[model samples]
Target: MLRVLLRTNALDDRVRKTLVDTLYTQPTNLAIGAITGVLCSLVAASYAPDRIFLELALLLTAIAAARIVMAVMLPRLRNRDARRMELLYEFGAFTYSAVLGVFAAMTVWYQLPATAQLLMVAYAIGYGTGIAARNAGRPSISIGQMILIFTPINVALWNGEDLAHRALAVAIVLLWIGMISITMTVFHTLRDSVAAAETSARLAEKMQHLARTDVVTGLHNRAGLNHYLVEYMSRRRAMPNLALFWLDLDKFKDINDALGHQVGDRVLSEVAQRLRAQAKQEAVIGRFGGDEFILACDVRDRREAETIALAVLADVTRPIRIDDDRLEIACSMGIALQPDDGEDLETLFQGADLALYHAKVNGRNQISFYDPSMSRNLVRRREIEAELRLALQRDELSIFFQPIVDLSTGRIRAFEALVRWFHPVKGELRPDEFIPVAEETGAIITLGNWITAQAARAAAQWPDDVTVAVNLSPLQIKAPGAAMGILNALREARLPAHRLELEITETVLLDHSKQTEDFMAELSAAGVRFALDDFGTGYSSLGYLNKYPFGKIKVDRSFVSGVNAGKKSDAIIRAVSGMASTLDMQIVAEGLETIEQVQAVQAAGCTLGQGYYFSRAVPDYLAGMLLARERERLDGPKRAIA
Candidate 1:
């Protein structure tokens, strides 16, 4: 029964058909050989006597030998067309076909009664036809092949030869066909079902990958990285020496602001490719959303891991291309080693991120190993950030106006607006301490807008002859239509554009030079003037001095303070004054502290100056009174030289 099922099972159509063809062909050939041998022997039985039977036997032997040879050699004939395994199946079919022929011939040689001879003949024919039908789409059906010992039981019983036997024979053939067909159907269904299930599973996996992976850089997102960390923790016992590296790109936002987002995307992809190439062979690298990337590795020790990290940094530090532009991108890397940094996944990640902060703080584009104290610093920074947001809401900030003096006339011309924060509980906070924190936390936008508005309002109450100068943060300039915001505030305050000066640092100009230039050009067109505040500090200032129509160039305190101390300072001031003189630009020397410093700046031909020697930054009300007193003092100077 197993053999029959194996031959007929629909595991594969080709194999089943090959087996059935062999079975059917064998019986057909056998029945033909048997009938021929029997008829020849019986006909010669009367004429040739004993020799007649021998002759028939010899013919039968030759025919059976031919059949056997054909069975064995048939596969070789189709060797080029059939696969090795398939050809083997065909050979087995041929052998079965020959076996049927030999069995029938042997029965004839035995001189069995006509009835038995006929039965053997019929069985052989039925088996041969079944074999032929296995391979061919069409094959001749043999009535003789259908009848056998089983056939007599069915045919003979109906004719009163043996009713019970014939009925059992018919039942067995029907049951066999039914079992084989059902088994074949099951096998076919199983194969199809498994194939479909596998395809669906693969498609689902691809979809999940797309969701987790970054489309431009092919890195995992923050959510994906979080899940990866969780999975790592689950098997962390086995990977006790695992390490995670977190990396963030420096000045990436500048690239987006300068170039376009399209180029930025290309640059990011290039960075990702470089990272993937240089990362440890065993490490899993992923993007932790936007300019951040992550690497999880299994390392033996700190030394081994540092070597990998150093290599990665070196490779990534190389220039990358975004179309026609080449960018020098660098990453600040932080390492957290498992079982050492922290036992749990979240703690380990937090430690690594904190270390990354240290890398950025000290100087970007460097690496730092995770330390226990980093977590403390991280907590403190988070607290600062929260407080900063609160400070903006509670109006804990105050503005101080510093006088801009005329170095030659010794009279104040305008006031520069400076911001000071009082933390209520923390007493006073300097701009250097809190300004950076605000910029990093994106609080600068709100703070800067308020400052601009406040300064404009305060300047409105000042004499028409005096102007207010406010410095703009880089974030503010890049904050989309920032010039419009300034203009709106000035208009709302009813302050003329000429009465409001915007102090821009050399850093802000260089950071987004094109944007800054465009903004300055637009506002300058509207009659608002630009001052190069803290000039002589950055390399781009001298170049910028010629590019835009600046109303004034404030001599950086470094130059102003050391004017009498060094020839270089004096020459710098003299050259700036000379340049302003030639271009008709006003020169304001800041930090004029003494009689000598004031004389030097005035001698350098600077027209405007400001310093503590004149007046420190004071409240709006005090500044108004101070301005009035300064005007009176200038008008009443040298009254009683006594």
Candidate 2:
């Protein structure tokens, strides 16, 4: 038992409980032990009753036993740990005995002769000294210490007188020990329990903090942001002008693709640091996910809001160093002013998203202010969204396949399926007129899936050498389960990925790092060809070419339009086409309306061209007729009649 107690750590709660329970049950055993000790003392004293020695011993035994029993049982009845309660009970027990012993010492001096009193004093002194020395090694200082110090002095005072006086003095020493024991047991128990409860409360608070704070960057996560947002918005009635700045890092995927994910995480940490550095005191910044972050602040004026936006743009655009490489990471910020954008959270959030889209469209790495025109765009988008749903149902939409030709060989390589909305009221609505709306409303996932399936089905009927190109919205790719949807669509259509080319805009590769990388890697591994569509429009074209895996780059219509105009735009076109060639990527120039535009693209070293220079986007039957005419020409006699 001693070995086991020595091996057990006292702080272990299980061991402590066992020790307390032992003390609680000790009251019964203590009573029997005390009675036995008293009877033995009486037996010895009966032989010398005149000496009064047995009476003194009996009195000491009875008082000690009664005090021990009361100290253990009282706290147990109160549901307290008996070990803790016993120490507190002993304090009072010892103090009371000290006063009683003094009173009895006076009585002993008055009653007994000198020798018997001296004997009583010596016994009391020895007992008290023994008790104090034993208890000093205990876990706490109880009433035993007071008994040790005072009982010895009281014994000396009584023992100076007669034998009768010695009996009273010993009885008083017993009473003082009992009183001290009770006080120590009760008070110390209360103190220990309070301390334990406070420690537990502090631990609980720390756990709550860890749950709310982000482990990596120490910023708030989506859950924490939502919690705080709800708390702040609860005071929305008083603070009406709450602004939400939805920020997405520009070309973040390109960085991840060029460097490893570890470096990408480092860049993200830096981005978070920049945000906190640039943020105003009132701003609450949090990571939404990947390279996306949110800045929520209560603003009262437009100028102040714009100032914050500019500061954020400036800070994020600063150069970040990872090992030896210094990278300039930029962000596109979209501002949605509250109550003006919407009275509620969801609508305001949508408005901010719309602004972000406008920022990327106009030119990324810049901030775009929310305007009423955004609402007009949203409305137009909604109408197109409604049409988009009904277009397939009512057969108002059809695929128009435009042939992709090799400029040098003049041979058809692929057919790009462009969707046209033949609106009943608004006749001949082109994709540009409605595709944005479809993407915004999250209907593009369905529309894009259909287009991929349709393109695959068409490619299956064509020559093995020819491929089908399908335009995919960034939003479609961003949505969860996107890769699964693409895979299932291809499998259902029974078309190999090699026969399908997915055209995605440069903006799609900007942010949403983890999602974009996963999607591209999965699809590319499956053998589907990808093209960087509308290049030279967003933040960085050359950077993307060097970063992502792409089969082709389609020059945006804006650059193509300017290729005919001046040296500046023409130089840009030439440089872009040359860059693509150097990278071993095919160049497809969009919006080739005239012979000059086509010739200019060809002059710029562009190999593939798609525009009205060939033919406008026509109906499916007309496109098939065009395909048939081209095939027949290839199979027919040579053009030279020498």
Candidate 3:
């Protein structure tokens, strides 16, 4: 039992180290033990005055002095091998207890003076108790010390012929048992506490990591990005030049609408991987939100930032394959430089966002660096967006009509309704000035609905044969209840659905969404004709013409302008007109400003024309007057026949 208790293997390595360190933590405890042991030895020698007693006294004195010296030097030796130091401390403790035990036993066995014997026994018990209390962190070592000290003294008392001495020995044995129990309890308590603390620390670290990581892309999330910014800013003096790049995937929404969100998530993950591969090792990258990513990296100047931005754009635009689909995606990047754009994260983010907006507005899949003018433009846009909201509520918007003429009869077929904002302070604002802002800010839904209703009401006032064409924004087409809303507008105006023609650009077909298909199908079933506007300006696939129920295809203004001037534009118009004729779709030549251009489109088989040559867009009153004039002209021929 003693050998087992003395072995160090019972405690874990960490617990053992902590216990050993605790043993030497209090030099005052070591000093007290040394002083008491030396005094006890001297008292025994003074009482006995024999050769063995004196020699034992001298040896105990030497050992006590050495323990004192060790305690004094402990601080200097703390940096040395811990295991060696722990062994040294244990050896010194055991030797001191063994020597004191022998000295105490001799005082009793030799029948020394009663005062000396009592003193020695009392000293031994006191020292053993002290060891139990002080060294309880290491139960084995503490119990071992108590056993060595008390066993010899108890043996000497039990060997005596006196009854009182044996009773004293039993009492000492009880005391030793109690001390051992207490030491074991203290050691277990301390060990369990350390284990709990370590466990909590590990749990806290894991939770922190989870909080900072993005689940979808396995990159840093917004919170993680904030953390990175804080840490980087702390060391900003060392790294003065930082380039913040904001990236947005162009037409990613089309992908999500056409495919699904699951595919969108996969694409985002792939994009993250590509960014990781292309970014510098020191760069901190994060996914800010849907389809948006941010990167902060060290760069010397705008030139280096531009170079990196171009490289990233090139790599990201490469084709990606998912399942059976080969998707080619493009990314627009905006860069803001540190100290030049802003010193902190908030300002830097604002600058980068402004630049990104500029890139998207100019053309997607390009890079823009921050400039002061972009900020002014952003402010102007915000003013427009805010005022435009009020404009909708205040009825500061109106519609104008551009007539589409039939080339064969030189008469009006339909009038396209175009929205114009008459700002009180800014006068009449063109659609191009505020329409993009409305579309981006989600105000187009309400505005587009208003236009549809107003156009329906105005068409009711026009000649029964003249139809009203209203252009639909991509947002308006994708909005819920869009078809129902248009039908409601026509119903409220008492206008037949046949008189309402909807003009849509090719962008609406890019999504290939079920909602859009359903929207078109519902409206088409209600006798609302659909025209493919700006037909050749976008993804001019003949597939759209075949898939969608388009009654008319309007040649883009660019092609109409080039007619009779270049063979390319003329050839494109001729081919489109021939295809439309085959599909039984009317072809309208747009942007015609000259008789020669009009004749060219007529000869190329275009049945209709609309441009400045016909008439610029006019208000509803003027449109009604023009329809009345056309009606009178048709009546004049009929009256002549009468």
Candidate 4:
């Protein structure tokens, strides 16, 4: 019974908030009701002039005072403190209903002027509206309040000694029953509306959770980790002992490629389980993306954090069986401690990432802590990337050409264009300084196109026997419509595709698709010649030689750099030259700095050579001068100054 009473009385936050909002209109309603009561009292006094007259007037005045007091007090309380405010308002409301019930029964108990009945009817209409407004959300209160107002009226009507008065009492009882039905319906509608709102809010919260969670591993995704990081940093002043571990599975791609992604996914799930088991209840473990996880730990000392990191690495690398085969895993982790590495999340992540990179670069399957100087190289790289972007837009980048000589004839054959950067503050930057940076940032596509156009235009002015060679980044050919763009540039320059040689590495074919094969075929059909650049350096060199039909093979400088001192390089060069001869492919040996090195490469049957010994890479005008000298030699000249 106690539980039932509590359940009936309790209104939820939403309903209580609604009740507070409706109470703001109570003041005006009470004042109007008070005025109607005064008029009713006057009419009753004129009719009675006796015992009930003064008593009725004072009773109405008291009820009006109680209502007016509630009107003034109710709206002042905060909506959040709704239970106390609602109780107080309900007490005032009960009093008003009881007093008004007695007033409604006045006509049956005492003789009154006909106009006094009119006043009572008007007061009852206002009373019914108040019940609907206050008690719709609370059905028990509506029942009690309505009963208090109408019970006395029914009693006074049935007390009369006549059929007409008894019939009137029956009619009032029926009407009260109808009002009770309306109260129950209104209560149900309000309850369902509140329930639906609560349900909707809960479903929205679930959707937010799914958005931040990883589906496969069931760990916090990058978004979820970022969310925790923001909250953690916001209160970082209070909790200063924290460390983040950017954990990576070393050479995990090899597993995916060799065993398949399905096996890889199972391994990842097992890894997540191990991390969760190793992590403390307070530690946050998140999937940083594929094959990578981040562990955030709360520890006072760096040694404690390092211990935890080592334990996690040990657990991750334990031999685990997948597909009935036991396999060993390797993991690399980078740790960033609070305040020492960074104070902000982005800086912390960058520091941790750089540490992870160093761990991988040194060797896989190890742990490294962040040091301040570790970011100097990263900062410099970022600075170079930023400046390189501006270099392209400002036209501060230019092309330089190195001459490739026909060793058999001792004449200049073709020039290879190399990109050079003119930094105003740093002087000249070579391709070794910025070319890898350009490829990593995808700036090579833009830089490559510009060089191709420039070299093509310069080559358009050369003799038919001479050719212009340009190096293409792997990124440029991998792009969509890349071959078409190169074709368009060459066609626009009116340079025959035969006089243009595109140099590519064997690595380019490692991940290339049939589209790449189709692209090469289209260019080859258009008379665009190709050379396998840096040959014999890649693992799949001989395979690429058979795979791609090349007009030339440029032997990498590593072999030629050791040409004079070693017989292995000489034999390898001889073997490559022999292969090139059988395949009808021209061979160019680079990095000939000494007369002995030049003679070694020439004896190995290399068709051409390029090095500082012949001439370093120079501007377009200088290359044109070298070509003019070659023409003069072909025509009438005996010799020219080297």
lDDT per prediction? 0.71, 0.70, 0.88, 0.80
Runs in model 2 deviating more than 4 A are 1-180, 226-242, 251-262, 298-300, 338-354, 357-363, 371-397, 402-416, 421-429, 433-616, 623-642
Expressed as tens digits, the lDDT of each residue in 171-267 for candidate 3 is 9999999988888777767777766776787899888878988889988899999998779777744455899999999989878988999999989
lDDT of 4 by residue, 1-642 (tens): 245336645656765566445544657765786767666665665666566666766776777777687678767655446666657667766766776677667765664555665466446545765575456666556667777777787787688777876776787677667776787677667666776777798899999899899887989999999997778666644345688899999868778877899999899999999999999787778999988899887787788888998999999999989977787899999989877888788888988898898787676799999988888877877888999999988888998999999988878889999999999999988788798778878998988999999999999988888899999887898788988999998999999989989998876777555666877888999899999888877454587777776889999898988544478888999998998899998999999898888999999989999999999999999998988877787765444433
Candidate 3 at residue 375, lDDT? 85
Q: What is the lDDT of candidate 2?
A: 0.70
**Model 1: CA > 4 A from native:** 1-162, 204-212, 217-243, 250-266, 299-307, 321-325, 330-340, 354-385, 388-393, 511-513, 560-567, 592-607, 636-642
lDDT winner between candidates 1 and 3: 3
**TM-score for each of the candidates:** 0.68, 0.52, 0.83, 0.63
lDDT at position 537, candidate 3: 78
Local distance difference test, candidate 3: 0.88
What's the candidate order when arranged by decreasing lDDT?
Answer: 3, 4, 1, 2
lDDT of 3 at 501: 93
Q: Which whole-number lDDT from 0 to 100 does residue 45 have in model 2?
A: 47
Model 2: what TM-score? 0.52
RMSD per candidate (Å) reads 11.7, 12.1, 4.3, 8.1
| 1 against 2, candidate with superior TM-score | 1
